[model samples]
Target: MTRSVYVTGIGRGDGRQVVELGMMELLTRQVDRVGLYRPLVHDTPDRIFELLRGRYRLTQDPATYFGMGYEEAAALQAEQGQDALTARLVEGYLRVAESYDTVLVLGSDFAATNLPAELGVNARLANECGASVLPVIGGRDQNAESVVAEVRNAHHAYTNLGCDVIAMVANRVDPDQLDSAADQLRRSLDVPVYVLPDEPALSAPTVRQIVQTLGAEVLLGDDAGLARDALDFVFGGAMLPTFLPALTPGCVVVTPGDRADLIIGALAAHSAGAPPIAGVLLTLGEKPGQDILRLADRLAPGTPVVAVPTGSFLTATELFGLDGKLGAGTPRKAETALGLFETGVDTTELTERLSVARSARVTPMMFEHALLERARTNKRRIVLPEGGEERILRAAEVLLRRGVCELTLLGEEDAVRKKAGDLGIGLDDPALDIVDPHTSPLRDRFAALYAKLRAHKGVSYELAYDVVADVSYFGTLMVQEGLADGMVSGAVHSTAATIRPAFEIIKTRPGAAIVSSVFFMCLADRVLVYGDCAVNPDPDAEQLADIAIQAAGTAARFDVQPRVAMLSYSTGTSGSGADVDKVRAATELVRQRRPDLLVEGPIQYDAAVSPVVAAAKLPGSAVAGRATVLVFPDLNTGNNTYKAVQRSAGAVAVGPVLQGLRKPVNDLSRGALVQDIVNTVAITAIQAQGDLR
Candidate 1:
């Protein structure tokens, strides 16, 4: 049975799409494939559906995404009956449910529809589909008493009609009334009642929404400003000095177009970052002169500036009435909605209540999402030595924006800041630490420590001083000295140059002979581990067995269970060679030492992973056809095979993760992308969890 959760609303203005988006997020985190269905919708295009489809990678047919248009449903109800409407909805839902593990059903909006008893209609459809209903009650502009009353009514109405009401949400409540409403609703309802405080940023209109609303002319700025949320409007009626103090971040400027002084002042304030204004609005259908317009562009190159034909009064009235919805354009709002939902609600508890079965196989997305969640749970500081690189800066922006971890970038401070500025990346905030290795206060201390550690080799502080100036060396010292939890580098350096410092200083972990590396080859449906790819060139039986054991532990760390495959040219003694003999010895050693592991050796590639080949060759062997960890005999074979599979299958390979290291220090490819950096950083953070001092 496909477990489905139906999010229905009572009347409109409830902002129920947040619940739908939140539910999609919750479901996708637990499963690989999730389908979306709307029982009823308007004839116009659905912005929420578009957002969900693009964001969640949903590929279900767009036609099957909805049961019927509102006009068609209402007409059917008037002509045939309510049973006809329910049956058609059930048919549409079953089609979608057959394709995915879970289905998220969106109930109809209460907008100019002719259906009888709109709320009751939603209840009947939920019953027909056998889905648990989560009704969202609108609390905006309502007192605590009314909010509590409506919560009780929505819960009773759904349960009384035989619909399984699993949870209730009271959204858009006034900030002052939030505590009282939450208290009253929680006491009144048996299920969970998550309350979301009213956010002006969600209701406040963006520059793009303003353009679409007033049909305004674009005088300046770009999409960045267009998507910016205008939280408040600052009417430019005062002089430059007095008005600059009134400016606020994410506020829109409203003034007469002839008032070039106000416009220039607001733009200057925004450029200074005292508070970055969202955009400027010109009223009375007047635009600034060409010279002033050029100045405006120079001040803040993409800050939105729009002009309207109406006066400021009427524009403000419409702007205040505008309430933004989650869509493809407003990703920031999606982030806001998700943050609010996550902060206020206990999703784990709610998920247990819903009781969707977890998938046995781990998808790449699930693994990646799990890594991020783990990192965020206990955020550790990660240092990027390639701070001057563009990809690192871009990844830093994403990491900080998602609140993933704390970062301290190592380089020449001025050069790093300039490169980040040139790429249009923001690194000026205090949360980020941009350090110049040459002038760092910790440089002397690190040099002394390095010299002390290498005194047996006749190394002095002078030699250690020069080496500490290198970014990779400095970053490694930071990790060793407890300044940073972990380090991710190699965007422009070699792999040996990246990890060589750790081998010298941090050393290997206890009870481990060699440091092995693994690449997480994320295929389309599942994640597989390919180990010893970049570290060992050639290994005897003992070293190969040790590598296999270390690689297995790394696989389990990332939640990919271990079923080891020692790859070679021969299969079950079919062929004999030195390489095959070595693999056979290593497989036997692993079985002898750790008998709990699933071991298969001298297995060809096809025999290892293909069911048909395994049945013909190694029948009924558990690890023959279903291997999660593939261990190559040598670096020559492992490196080439991993690259070939990556390019041919179009898989994302996150790797060269060094196992058996005392401290966590990972290397990146010289050509890593922004997302690759993010993933590597996340992996590094997880690796540092046990060693946090």
Candidate 2:
């Protein structure tokens, strides 16, 4: 049985981060699963949802799991009184508790000694969920009396409500006062008391962290200001074909001179449209050409454009390294990135760290409509290739009703509808589109193109048609032609089979030498990206260089700065071989082609990942031991190696996240699990939103 815990106390002054971190720690202790429920969040403008989405990367919205909107939930909290709120909260908690072995109940910020009416609600909820409550106290000022009062209140609430009190955590305590606070608090409370230290500014989120983790140099803008409050970084344009993902919007590093076309293109593609520019650092210290100046004037007129003396745009990257402004700013994404990197935290670790705990005894409920509504509001789009398989249909139906995406299933409308109905999957809405490959306008176009291209190859028209009719081909075509923003296939195909069509029909973006695959490995503390795993069998030096470049770019797309490490069996010049030679050559190529990229190669895996190993193997290398992107020499090494790490090292593999396509299109293994499908869709949606440039 999976050990399960419930997390409450979200939205109570750092309560969210506290509960999230606590749950993550618990998960590392071999817990089977950890779940969080926000039963009674205040009615705000999707702040809770945004928090969940941005901080935790949760795909399911609050409404879906709780059967209440943020507004409705807030209203219920006020009108229904504590008893009613507790009942509703408990009902939801129990619904999620059935799947786990043990559930950890998170407490709210309201005092345990609140009015009897309010106490009853919390107590009742805990009892119904069959969860033992763990009071997580967020110590804002660390007052002894206040702390004691909070604990006593919690104890009374739990006892009166007929629930067990397992433990109590005093979160975010000042280091100097931690001992006294813990001692005083423990003496007053019956539960075990744990004091969590106040994290340093280094522990806080900042842009410097993001930049260093990605191995990207700060091109322009005030690093201090950017470190604080920069939300999304937008990277796009014709230059996007050559643009690195390392420059997200809050940092707004411009391609020197009059590359306003790039900026305009990126702005047009942004989901929220373009955010106000933080600042623009002109690359190469060049003035905008007349056309570019005109475009910039029309688009972002007052945005400051800082100039550096670097002659070439690429040379401007050196400014980031020279700035020496790593630790400045509040709400700094860079700082967050650095803190995350320093602790070696990957995406999985971060996600786990942010998960909340729930109770095991509660009966889990499926609030399909709520989930669907949230997905719809988020404008998520999930693709289902036409075959009308029962599993696919059922999955699609559940996802659709829950508002996961604008569902696109490939097949004749009649057949798809029949299959859906037969499978008990409802699809009576206009949002669902059914396309028959044989009759699709795009398919016909592909057929014509293929026939013309292969006419002299002795391939019959029928054969050409058959090849173009493959779902993978059609799906790639959808992404290429903008019919769909992204695709998820591989349920009935091999990786090669899924990818071959993309390679042939979709083609690489101009200047991209090879298409590569990256695996977003989610570990306990951080996300480590492995690349060239699914594509590029035995990449040459040039190909390896492109893989490194593309892999780094991909990291940036996901808000991760690329710290590229060109991996080989040897460290530095320790070994001599075609493989090592290729790595060394590729490393140089990356330095030459993208001088801004922090890349080093001819390094062993251990040296690339472990600081100790890196120090011993290659003392002076910048990327040694700190590399975020690992480029393998061949498929044999990249594929087998990453799989071995996934199984043995216990990393949650998130992708074969395909990169370098004109749009966001990825293939799945034929036997992809449901969760795999869900994650792929999420990743695709994110990519689609950013693919506008």
Candidate 3:
């Protein structure tokens, strides 16, 4: 029988769509063909379903995804009483369950329905469909004790109705209260409980959502502006200087359209990137003059501006009622929601609870999901030296929003804020720490520490003071002094600049001869660990063996079972040379040191990974052609090979994650994208967890 999972909420504003979307993300990673079923939907189009279909490429018919419209279902329930409604929804769910390997059944919202008790209705549907229930309890304005009590009550409510409650989630609590809230919930409930802090971005109304809610006329803006989230609302009634300071990043400015001075001043501030507003709301049916509108257009080309007939007070009232939703136009919000859910929930345990088995194949999405889930465990703090860089700040936002780990961005505070403002990114979260390395109080302390560490090298405190002022050195000192667990740099600096401080101050780990790097090459169907690609020009026989051992440990740390393959020119004495001899010696050393490790060597790349080639070249050799971990002899070959495969084969290379370090410090390519930084940061956090134990 096909498995079904039901995601339902107890009340309104529970934000359960995050759970539903997150569950779908996990399901798709486990099963090849997953279907979606909505027991009851509003009369409007199912926005969340549309988003899932577009994102996951579901082949199920759009019409088949839903059972009945809200009015139709409520009428049936009122006429034929509850039995008719239950039968209709169960029929829709069974169809999807029969057609796909698994089905994600979205339950009804308690509010905006005619049913007497939506909770009871949802329980009956879950029980009738033979689905596992994930009950969501809202904790937006509740205390920790109250949230825990509500969750326990939810479990009783579901279980009393004979529904199999797989887990309970306490969502939308204050960020600072999450830890205490989660602790209480875990202690109170017997089943698995996950706690997600409130995300203001999800609750904030986007420009598009606001437009639809208010029926406002769009005077100016593009699609990108429409998607910008309005985090806060600022009323424009005071003088230009006073109002300008109130205009914040991602806020909608509400003012009279005739006040071109306030309008022009806001736009100018946005142009200067002081703090970019979401859009300007023209109240009282007022519209800007053609000349002023054109100036606003040139000031910020794509910034949104809408006009409504209602006054400021009424407009604010309606705006406050509107909340953002996860859908097709809001892909970024969807990503944020998914990250929050994955970070807070223990997905491995959740799968076990549901008895869902994941596929052996490791797709890129699955690998990315694992990276996020693993980083969340230890919650290490990572410092970024190039904090003011656009890509770094964006990555920092993603990291913090996902609750993956703590972050300290090192730079000039004012400059970083202005840059982030211009990009329309919000940095108001309390967990985010921004430090100016030059002006930080820790500068003198770090300088003293650096001088002492380098005293034998004739370094004085004064000279070390200047050295510690550099962002890279300051960040590295944080890792050395235990202020941060790791550091990720090289976004704006050379690789040498990024790692020079680590080698000088942090140094290598004990029982390790050298530091090397590996890239987790994410192919179409599998993830292969490629090592020593970015560091160490060449290694002797002993050093080569050490790299293999370190690389194997790193692979296993990330849940990738290790099968070590030492690469060289020859395959089992088929050829002989200086390179082949070194590889052969290294292979022997590995066999002696780690006898349990499956080892092969002086093997060609083809024979190491291709079963057909292994059958012909080195028959019956255990480690040939099925290796999960591939250790190259030198940097030149490994670097070129990983790059070739990454580009030619369309693989995602997630690394040069440094191995054999005392503390975790990773580097990024100067040309890295936003996602590249996110992946590397997550990897660094996971590496730090290993350091802790």
- How many clashing residue pairs appear in each of the predictions shown? 0, 56, 1
* Model 1 TM-score, all chains together: 0.86
By TM-score, the candidates rank as: 1, 3, 2
Candidate 3, clashing residue pairs?
608-625
Q: What is the Cα root-mean-square deviation between model 3 and the actual structure? A: 4.5
Any idea what lDDT model 1 has? 0.85
Q: What lDDT is reached at residue 580 by model 1? A: 92
- Full-model lDDT, candidate 2: 0.58
Ranked by lDDT from best down, the candidates are 3, 1, 2
- For model 2, residues 1-693, the per-residue Cα lDDT tens digits are 323344443224434344444343334333334445545444433343344334333434345345343455456667876556666666766665565444444444353323335445545666666555555555656665666566566566666667665555566566677777777866776556566655533233234444444343443334333343323333333455555434443344445455765655443322122223344444454665566545554543333344444554344344333322222133222223222322222324323433434332211111111222233445645566735765566556445433456778887766665444322233555667878887877766777776665677776667877877777777766766667777877777687877776776677778788778898876655567899888778888998898889888888766456889888888887899887898899999999999888888888889988999888888877888888788888999999998898889877777788888767677776666655665666666766666421
Task: Give per-residue CA lDDT, model 3, range 142-181, as digits (tens).
Answer: 8887888888889999999999999999899888888998
Error of 1 at 120 (Å): 1.0
Top model number, TM-score: 1
lDDT value for candidate 3? 0.89
Candidate of highest lDDT: 3
Output the lDDT of residue 165, model 2.
Answer: 58
Model 3 — which ten-residue stretch has the worst lDDT?
A: 417-426
